[model samples]
Target: MDAHSAPLPAAAMPANGFGRFAGHLDRALGGLVETVAALLVVVEIVILGAGVMARYVFHAPLVWSDELASILFLWLSMLGAVVALRRGEHMRMTGLVSRVSPQTRALLEAVAITASIAFL
Candidate 1:
């Protein structure tokens, strides 16, 4: 399956306006982060290209060439994580929880989220 086709567990059916808007906001954030990350990738590529040209042709690499590349990659990864979380794209283990009643499911979800945060 493609990246966008990955399935997500049905969470508490969002009924209220706040819930719906929150979902919308999440999707918007995901899109925005993806756009920004793509632009950053282009910038990284250009800089890396310049580094390669200078290193081969001029025989002098910039002092901070490797460090800059690492920082750009790190930024892309962190932004990608935010995008994944917003899209519910993280690997979620919800098999057993799917069989439970809504209330119990919510409780378990809360507990799991808390544990995840604590672990992080």
Candidate 2:
């Protein structure tokens, strides 16, 4: 299945005024980040390919490509992290907790989140 078919995270659920606005904001930011990350992948590939050709085929190295690629890669990874978190893909604990009672689920979710943060 395509990534677009995946279910949305809890943050995107319906809510009151402020919460609804927050959800929209979160989704908008996620889309923007995802778009930029996709674009960066294309750009990094083009830059690296050109750099390779310049260094080998033409006997001239593109010194700036390495640094540029590194910075873009860092940004891509950070954006990916943000998207993963927004989509609740940061942990598998939720899937297991979902079968339990609400109270127990809440407690487990909190513990899992805290543990994840501590690990980070």
Number of the top TM-score candidate: 2
Taking all chains together, each candidate's TM-score versus the true structure is 0.62, 0.67
Give me the runs in candidate 1 sitting further than 4 Å from their true place.
Answer: 1-13, 88-116
Q: Model 2 clash tally?
A: 0
Model 2 over residues 31-71: C-alpha lDDT tens digits? 99889989999999999999999999999999999999999
**Decoy 1 TM-score against native:** 0.62
As for candidate 2, its clashing pairs are none
lDDT values of the candidates? 0.76, 0.79
lDDT of 1: 0.76
RMSD of each: 5.5, 5.1
